[model samples]
Target: MCGILLHHAGDDDLYHLKEQFLEFPEGSLSSKRCSDGSPIFNSIIPYISARGPNYSSLRVSKKYKTAWYSSVLSLRQPFTCQSIEIEERYVLQFNGELYNHEIVHNDTQYIVGLLKESAPSIPAIIKKLNGEFAYSIYDIQNGTFYFGRDTVGKRSLSYFLDENTGEFYLASVTGSQPNFIDCTAGIIYQYSTRSKKLNSDLSISSPYEIATTMDQQLTKLPNCIDGLFEHLNKAVHRRIVSIHPAHIENSPISILFSGGLDCSVIAALICKQLSNIKKEKKPILELLNVGFENPRTGMLPKDVPDRKLALSSSEILKNLYPDVTIKLVNIDVSYEEYLEYRPKVIDLMFPKQTEMDLSIAISFFFAAKGSGYTISKDGIKEKYQRKGIVLFSGLGADELYGGYHKFANKSPDDLAIELTRQINNIYDRNLNRDDKVIANNGVEVRYPFLDEEVIKFSTMEIPINYKVNKMILRKIASEKLNLATISDEPKRAIQFGAKSAKMTKDGNKHGTDILTS
Candidate 1:
């Protein structure tokens, strides 16, 4: 949603700080300054600014010897700037949405008010937040700095420390800087501004409670499907609403659709929602399917498994929901085009350079770029660039519902442990990498399945029988959603489904292997 950066230092080291750990190139550093005439620690963050190109601001508190920088994409409000001061005391740089109906206009101002009410209890406020976010709040009163992300790391935040100078640096991203690490999800990292030490202590635990036994079997088989269905329906609706009116020509919402069970089920829910809205206000649903051509095998993008399945599934949805309009965007990537963006995308995926990372990021990179084709009136393969800035991804379904192939072999006890492990670690493995790649194109990706309510219902309430193969979701698709034939679509990785894998051509190379380059 936005990019944030902060640096804290003492008087002795404030002016003498070197770029050993937080260096930027010579000319890339923006000469931008704060409200007054003073500069903002001379912030150098050209790498992370792509995520928020709409507006950029830098605020410096020379009294506190701290610099705060933020750039905004402005998806929620046209003029809601960052580094928002709560009652002009607590300085906050927030990136991501806060889905509370009571606070309508700006989430930052609303959150600052919440911070005021709870004064310094950060975790208490974090527990009340039901949406995805990554933020840093500097309590000018107590000189204690705090930063963290939502329980489900839906946004990206990276940080580093200079041991020699005791200067600390945190940003939405600091590209390829050695020892610069991603802040873990579900943690409140803090340090005292008075001390000016570079070390960060685990401030406190988060609100997430993983179920040791993944299944409760609380709801009977008949009602299990209904419970999950209702939970997911509300989740999808929460993300879908609050879209500002049709500012773009076509639509503002899209799904990173592969025609798989996870994505198709979301599409079905959106279609039903779309049907209920009036005809004049209908927001077109754009389903984006990406495929890659294989130069070595002489295979074309159209022949890719993802392309075939997407075309097949489009017809089923069309036949089932005649009233709703669905646009299937066939995004074909030639071998040369994939090579063109590979270097930049890999740069965006920083600190995570694996053959598997490239394969997965490549699919999302093109999908977020949103340059593809849709059938025009004349049935011509017309050139179309997706106007939607918000893309829905079916990311957390596998971790939450045991949709992975590896989950098939594990016993119920082991399955419970593995599911907990994967979901917790998803921040570093998948969410962080995906956020950097997708947000690099100035688009926001939301995962409805990862919503707190949805995750709680699926993992805690649903039975193990329904969790395996994600039978509950399949049933919802078949009976509840009325996409009968789609229930058979098995789980497939985007790399294989989109034909982006095995292109590294490292003979018998595994996905976990680090990139040779």
Candidate 2:
């Protein structure tokens, strides 16, 4: 929903704290006022305004001299303001969608209400947490703060501490800061205003538990297509239904499509749901496909691997769902444009600076930018700047369903261990970087395959036979959904498919190379 920040002022002078980890992106101070009617920030950094382009604010507790900052994207109703405060005793700053449908109108309010009513323990709040989030709740009465991200770490949260004065810091993003750390998901830390040091972390279930739950659910039903289909269907439906009507006005539901198994599967479900669930009239759904113009390989932007795949898949979708208007928005980024955005992409992926990160970020940055074109049925092209606030990403399918082919050769035991590792590493390897890059474009990114239920059913539940090459998901696509070659296409990493890799004469640069520029 927004970008968030919290800082505990060690000294009365807030000016010195501003120049530390916060002095990177740009130096325009945010002008949004807090609920208490005070300026949100005296200074700011990053492309901070972009994350919460709809609303921005800073809430301060004069007694503690601590400040909480939240910038909202406002994709739902109730236009809930943040930092959300309740009973004048508790305050919250959250950045994520509560797709749980717990608070259909305003997720911010739902969470702030929980933080207000729940006990001091972290479990009290986590037991009900649903969907992706990075959150901080302050107990004004007790001088305590609780902060954590969802177990899958689907959102970004970074932290820093100044030991000399026992001051604490947190932010949605802190780019390449000397001491700031991207907080690990599934761990909650409590900070006391009196001690200023952090308390022992309240641990939650490990990501491995998700694997365990999937196994348990799958044991009873050998053929789990019906169950798997049910969960998958619900996952896509909740993501759409949760957005308020007013917020989704005229904004097409956009997909970060790759024309591969993952995105095509999601695209099918979304098309089905808009007709069955939303029932919105002749809704236009955009398939945002990104392709890069790499000169080294003689690859034209229009002919990039993913673009061809998208054109093929677009035809499949059009043939399948004639009721909905399916627009394939080809987001072609030129070499010049890539160079122009490289620096900003690097900054957005703060603390994660690698050629691989840059490539992936650039791919998503342009895709989400949606500044491309949509072709008419008559083959005429029309310029389209996607106002797609809700961007569906097919991110977690590979991690959850064994989409990587290498795991196919591993033994049963090794495969289980590998799957567990993939689940745990998603936070570091994908979610953080992807979330920052996608959100930087002023859009919210959602993972349908990562829905807690979807994870529970896919992990260990579907037969190991189907998991190889993600045959299980492929089966769902082919047998149940009746999709075409999309159901059988081999997996392709987005960077390679989009031609975002090996950008220059450093064409031989490995994907893992630490970015120097």
Candidate 3:
């Protein structure tokens, strides 16, 4: 939910270092002094805050020109505990919600308390923690830094390290950097289970070839459903806990609610938790739903009918939570407009794949970004300052819950197999779209359906009948939150909802082009 920038001089090259720091705007700077009387310079606050209401905190070291910027976004309010500290020469930044924080805290205190007994290494401390997290710890103590994006890669952390300067910049989104070093194209490495070690990285000519090999190996694993669910749930819970209350109370968390089970579930869970906390005042939970205008003549596919799921979803949500503010945007862009924006959308979403279906999906993302949900006060003048708003989406629900027509013939055993396959496919297909659309605006995204706990419980314990076409989720919604009324209704993809006119070209039909065709 924030951006961090650091500049270091290998020798007495202070002039260039200062110039680099000045390139980002003056108001963006914030300074704090360390225990050793060194000043830490930071400028990410103004850049992030102008995007929306958020709690911004910064730490900078004057001697090192090393800065750490952290912001708790209102979109991720009601977080557990969030803090960044500089201990000696090391800077630690963590976005996480530890299930066993109290226990770990006490253990750390006890260990640190018994200085005469022994001390734990940094790696040992990391091993004692359990949860979903993406953290970067810069050890100025050793002039070396370490960063990891959790074991499951649920939380995102991307960085570009300067080989010439040994300077590293890290952010939650990949495209945040305007300029980056051109690292050679392909790299591959494998982790050894027996040795519990990672192999040295290797470069390859074709990344897809390695990916295919890995996919085949992953498909061979037993209990794929259990493993997939476990990882997914862990991802969701990690993000939920990462929300800081100060940030939530300041700006309010925004949810892209489609009234579908995935987004609806996330909205419900966040609302349920926020209602319990007694903050400065109850933060607003904003729900954004986008609709499209009528299609042109002959645009409708013979098989697909118009369905306003966005409007219906808003109504259902209003019935459930009368307090939330729902913003529905009916996009009226013409086919010509779509063509104009198609390339940018394609570049953002399908940077790797140029398939037509992905392009269609990217069009929906383009419309959503333009819907004003991610717009900041500064406007869209610059991409980085557009907004730091974190968008919560439900991208993997259909794939994991058998909500697609492809799962119609799946038996109980076959259902598990298919679900696992779909879950794996999410990273390349759905995650690609989600990340591209939101990150293009400098906004972060969270997928609650991909939560590890929810995935594990739903897949391992819940009966197959419950998940077959979201049957179990519907029942749970009725019993736990009364969500079943709309569960039986058919699911609609965003592309079909927003661009129905484009669906019938060349005798092709909507939905069929994707699932059955």
lDDT of each: 0.75, 0.78, 0.46
RMSD of each: 4.5, 4.4, 10.4
TM-score of 1: 0.89
TM-score winner between candidates 1 and 2: 2
lDDT of each residue in 1-517, candidate 2, tens digit only:
7888877766445532221112112223464322222122333333456787776665555566677767788877777777777787777777888775556578877776666664645457765788888888877777888888887899998877776676677888765565777878878877877777677457666556423333434554436877888899999988988877654546779999989999999999999987764545677789999999897777878899899999999899989998778899988898999999998889888788888889898899899989999888788989988877899989988877788878879766677778878988899899888888888888899899988888877875665555668867887898777785788799999889999998776657897888986
What ranges in model 3 sit over 4 Å off?
A: 3-85, 93-133, 140-145, 157-252, 271-283, 292-307, 323-341, 356-390, 500-517
lDDT of 2: 0.78
RMSD of 1: 4.5
What's the C-alpha lDDT at position 207 in model 1? 38
- Give the lowest summed-lDDT range of ten residues in model 3: 205-214
lDDT of 1 by residue, 1-517 (tens): 6888887764443533222222222233343322222123343356556777776666666676776777776665545777777775788888887777786766776777788884558656766676878988888887877888788788988877665555677877765556777988877777665665533445334434345443355457778788889988888887766555443224657889898888888888877776766656545777899999976556788888888888878878777677676788989999889989888778788888888998999899898888999987687998888877888888988888889998998887787778878887888889988988888887788888988889888767776656788777888889997787878898899999888887745468888888765
Q: Which is the better candidate, 1 or 3, if ranked by TM-score? A: 1
Model 2 stretches astray by more than 4 angstroms: 15-46, 101-104, 118-122, 209-222, 278-280
Q: In model 2, where is the ten-residue run with the lowest total lDDT?
A: 18-27
Expressed as tens digits, the lDDT of each residue in 390-501 for candidate 3 is: 5666666786567887788866667777776666555544554454455444455666665545554555555455555775555545555566666556666665544433
